[model samples]
Target: MGFRQRTMENLVITPAFWQDRRVLVTGHTGFKGGWLALWLQTMGARVIGLALPPATQPNLFELTGLAGQMVSILADIRDRDALAAALASHRPEVVFHLAAQALVLPSYSRPAETYATNVMGTVNLLDAIRQTGCVRSVVIVSSDKCYQPRATACTESDPLGATDPYSSSKACTELVAAAYRSSFFASGDHRGHATALATARAGNAIGGGDWSTGRLVPDAVRAFADRRPLLVRHPEAVRPWQHVLEPLAGYLILGERLYQQGARFAEAWNFGPGGETAHSVADLLTKMAGMWGGGATWRRDDETHPHEAQSLRLDATKAARALPWHPRWPLATALQMTVDWYRAHLDGQDMVAVSRQQIARYCECEPKAVAP
Candidate 1:
């Protein structure tokens, strides 16, 4: 069916939909969080960001200058008291929880910190919502890695488990959400009258402005920028890559569903590309090199690192059918947009305008409606 010909049975975006809506985004200084903050601002939402200080130099948060766009709070998610105070003062209508020790390698180095931030930090946010009694909906951002190893594209109903510290901690966060939603947010519970919570599993994301150390695309870009050979680990491993905004749009749409349907829509959802394309690290590097005009090369990392998933893909059909969600940019276009952003920044273009322009471009291309 044509995009416009499809029925409007699911939530979709409009310019003024988020106007006057209060949204609290944790991890606003991080890569995906920064993008979400900027997107919400474009929708005219009142966004308040809560997270630890932006990471050291070469950070996406600082690179995008997102702190100036929202009420950025310098606090750790593990600090329940601080998080609670911020939630109470802000009284957000919707909360997007994205703060965590997001790196798998670092999680191996500091397993305890990972658990504290990912597992307990989630508990803290849930407890704070219980206290505030003002939050209407919350979307807990998790990863496709939360699923147990499977060669096929995993669905949301597949068993949930994780091998590494980072993935396992996210699994624990999912458990926390399940428990709280069942125990406290049920129809008969005291706090059930106020809030509904859900989880979203996003596939591997790639875009510009990401400067995180150890990530594939960012590492490649940084090494190339410095005229060094990028290191490639697990070059044969496959991932479902899409632009960052694709999943962010899914999260916001799910948030809107939770607002309308309340407990009925409070369930786990997957946001990813429509199909599995086994784009390995080598394949991604080749794509990036081609997009960057052929001056980049890579070598395998010598030191042994934590194990990441060998192959990963997700089935977002449920989101497509239930929420009418569809990915706008295909794989090649996503990579080109990423490379173009980095090129613009390196060429001394105004990055703030560049980022905003990308956001506008994505929205304009978004499919307004679709058939299941």
Candidate 2:
């Protein structure tokens, strides 16, 4: 199959496409991966999750009861033999490679571990996939920070560079994917074993069930729930924030295209909210405080911290034109959804049902233009 122009009407994620398909999701215990795995389950995919135990105490993977839903394998991606054995046994038709050292501040303290996990971990997965020979579509999740720091929005064509260890590792991860794609999974290979592989770079994704340390939304949720003030670092740092579902939707669509359309869709893509959604940390916190409605507050931290990017944006025009994807929820709605999820959790509500309801609502939402 070859790539064809898709209309907005058909851009909605097709549950029929994923139904009963064998899918492998690495990092299924993390926030984004958890959401993706849950969504796949809802669509009746036979999901196989391979990753270490949840890193945080109250992580989404356990909170949502995902272990009971899929075949959850406790293993590390850095372990080459284990990873290869797992892939060989499961033989998934689709793979979403998301396991990595995702946090930036932590990367400063654990640089070697970060490189080994993000860079070599990727090498392990790609090599395993090549040997396993059952995967037809692969979506490798990278970060928008893979681009060199710039004041403007970054396009997929932008040069890949990074100042921080986390970002540098992600750039190297991208290079590894590109190398594997070109060498083993090249488009239209005569050997007839080519795999359609693509990379997705997304902006700051905020949502519920994310208790990871050093994140804005989770920290705010904890502080507000505890009746304490949230401390802010780099309050003026600007990020193109969107609900987690936005990029997850992009990943699903990209995976589908890679499976059905082969080479044309096998390339790097950017999935981000519109430019108008870009806001400073302070601005986001203020809005979050108002939404929380309990006098939740934040103050700038005086302690010196490791360097972080002040401004970052992504140009998702390629995805918009090719996959015909767009942000369905605006920032205000996204923040409200986040607050609502935490409030439900605090109230002892069933988080899996709440999360599933949000996913259904997101799928039903019509694409709206970003409000300035």
* Number of colliding residue pairs in each model: 0, 0
The residue pairs found clashing in candidate 2 are: none
lDDT top scorer: 2
Task: Give the range where candidate 1 is weakest over 10 consecutive residues by summed lDDT.
Answer: 2-11
TM-score of each: 0.92, 0.95
lDDT score, candidate 1, position 143: 90
Tens-digit lDDT string for candidate 1 (15-57): 4557779999999988899899987886678999999887756
Q: List the residue pairs that clash in candidate 1.
A: none
lDDT per model vs. reference:
0.82, 0.89
Model 1 superposed RMSD (Cα): 3.8
Q: Model 2 — which ten-residue stretch has the worst lDDT?
A: 1-10
Report model 2's TM-score to 2 decimal places.
0.95
User: What's the distance in Å from true for residue 308, model 2?
Assistant: 0.6
Model 1: residues with Cα > 4 Å off, grouped in runs = 1-11, 187-193, 366-372
